[model samples]
Target: MKIFMKILGIAILIAIGVGFYFRLNDDVLTGDRIIGIAVLTSAFILMPVFLYVRWKGKRLKDYTLSEENLKKMRDKGID
Candidate 1:
């Protein structure tokens, strides 16, 4: 999964770079379409997979602020 994410991220970045190259040379419309598609793919597909992989096996309560967490923080001189 980690390898897959890395490959996907690199591919998307390469696509964006190619899009910019095209835009600078001649095909503005095609470049724009490629850039748009790459951005959308990163946002919708790559982001979710990355987030899921990173967040897997983690406790949500540890990150969220609640009354108990606030008390603990105050006890530890953080608040």
Candidate 2:
């Protein structure tokens, strides 16, 4: 499922790029309108799905500066 979402997100991003490229060349008003809609749809779908797949099963606490983590950071001289 994660792999599928990743692929879908990549595909949508590519589609948006292609649509934008065509949009620059299109002179017809309706053609530009279609490209605009396609780009917006790709963006809306790409963000959430990609983020979900990227962050799925990851703990937010592990990345935060809790007491234990802060101590480790201090030990490493990274803080």
Candidate 3:
């Protein structure tokens, strides 16, 4: 899973770079399409995968603000 995420991230970044290269040196329409597709893929596919990988097996409440958590933070001298 870690290796897959790394490869996906690198591939997306490469696609974006290629998109920019095409935009600068080739047809504007093709370049824009490539860039748009790349951006959409990152937002929809890459982000969710990354989030799942990072948050897997973690309790959501631990990261959220609740009265109990707030009190704990205050006791620790955190604002």
| TM-score of every candidate relative to the true structure | 0.86, 0.63, 0.79
Which tens-of-lDDT digit does each residue in 1-79 have in candidate 3?
8898789888888888888888899677888888899899889988998999898999989999999999999999999
For model 2, residues 1-79, the per-residue Cα lDDT tens digits are 6777667657666666666666677645655665676567657875677777789999999999799999999999995
- The most accurate candidate by lDDT is 1
- The number of residue pairs in model 3 that clash at the backbone is 0
| Pairs in clash, predicted candidate 1 | none
Task: Report the poorest 10 consecutive residues by lDDT, candidate 1.
Answer: 1-10
- Candidate 1 residues lying further than 4 Å off, grouped into runs, are none
Better of 1 and 2 by lDDT: 1
The 0-to-1 C-alpha lDDT of every candidate, in the order given, reads 0.94, 0.72, 0.89
Error of 2 at 39 (Å): 2.2
Order the candidates by lDDT, highest first: 1, 3, 2
